[model samples]
Target: MDSATHQSLLNAARQVFEAKGFTRTTIADITREAGIGRATFYVYFASKEEVFAAPAHQVRDQLVAAQ
Candidate 1:
């Protein structure tokens, strides 16, 4: 996996989701925010939902570790 690209996408997705909210955000919005092609997004994530889950999972893992 291209970690740099993946992190870029994650950061972009978070920004977009925050700005537009989940229902209003689209894969195109995320890719646009990431300054990458839509196809590149699919190469890293199957769907917007999957990408959205990445940060959530990270937070969950951190909470668990802190417990």
Candidate 2:
């Protein structure tokens, strides 16, 4: 997928994961919020757990950099 699409998925995943938490948020939730398909979500991330990690790590990196 392209960078724009990937970032959209990541942003949508972050929203859903934050609201619903990792275990409760499904592929459907991410894709629906992203306005993409299930296959599209899988193209970028292997699973919900993987999706959760990226944003959390990004936040951590930003926080550390600010310190």
Candidate 3:
């Protein structure tokens, strides 16, 4: 996928995972929030767990950069 599409998926995944928690959120939920299709979500992430982890990793990177 293109960078815009990937970022959109990541942003949507982050929102859904944050709101509902990883275990409770579904691919459909992320896709709906992202205004994309469920298959599109799958193209970007393997699962909800990965979605949750992605933001956490991003936060960690930001913190490290700030330090």
Candidate 4:
């Protein structure tokens, strides 16, 4: 429930997503990179797409902020 753990997941997901692209990335891959359990991932996110949206929006937000 802490932001640290939530952000950890996001950071890990971003790394894996950038490396593998969305189609090739899996829940196991993200959890492994995040150093967390699958249940832990589910506790924060309902699905991979749900997790993906956050980072995607983050990227968008950064772009908007920079302009």
Candidate 5:
């Protein structure tokens, strides 16, 4: 999958995770929000936890670059 698609998944996951919390959120919830297939999510992320960390990692990397 492309970076745009991967980003979409992460965005969708962030929304769902915020709304439903980690325990309640499922892959289907994220996929539905992203308008993508469940399989597509797997192409970008191994699990919700990994996806959740992606944005944090991005920010951390940016901060490190700035420093």
Candidate 6:
């Protein structure tokens, strides 16, 4: 997938995950937050859990870099 679209989804998922928490957030919630359809989300991610990891990894990297 292209970086821009991929980044958009990550950003959206991050917001939803933060606001709703992992257990409460759904793929539908992430897609809606990204302004993309459910099928489009599938093209990039196998599941909400997969997408959640991307942002979590990014956060970890950011924190590690700050130190």
Better of 4 and 5 by TM-score: 4
Candidate 3 colliding pairs: none
By lDDT, is 4 or 5 better? Answer: 4
Model 5 steric clash pairs: none
lDDT against the true structure, per candidate, is 0.95, 0.90, 0.84, 0.95, 0.90, 0.89
Model 1 residue runs over 4 Å out of place are: none
Q: Candidate 2 overall Cα lDDT vs. reference?
A: 0.90
Candidate 3 weakest ten by summed lDDT: 1-10
TM agreement with the true structure for every prediction = 0.91, 0.90, 0.82, 0.90, 0.79, 0.86
lDDT by residue (1-67, candidate 1, tens digit) is: 6599999999999999999999999999999999999999999999989999999999899999999
Task: Give lDDT tens digits, candidate 3, residues 1-67.
Answer: 4588788888988888779888888889888988999887778888777777878998999999999
- Model 4 spans > 4 angstroms off: none
lDDT string, candidate 5, 1-67, tens digits:
5589998998998899899998999999999999999998888899888988888898899999999
Identify the superior model by TM-score, candidate 1 or candidate 3.
1
Clash count (model 5, backbone only) = 0
How far residue 23's Cα lies from its native spot in candidate 1, in Å, is 0.8
Question: What local lDDT score does residue 45 receive in model 5, on the 0 to 100 scale?
Answer: 92
The TM-score of predicted model 3 comes to: 0.82
- State, as a TM-score between 0 and 1, how close model 1 is to the true structure: 0.91
Candidate 2 lDDT, tens digit per residue, 1-67? 4598899999999999889988899999999999999997888999888888888999999999999
- Expressed as tens digits, the lDDT of each residue in 1-67 for candidate 6 is 6687788899999999889999999998988888998998988999988998887887899999999
User: What lDDT tens digits, residue by residue, belong to model 4 across residues 1-64?
Assistant: 4588899999999999999999999999999999999999999999999999998997899999
Best by lDDT: 1
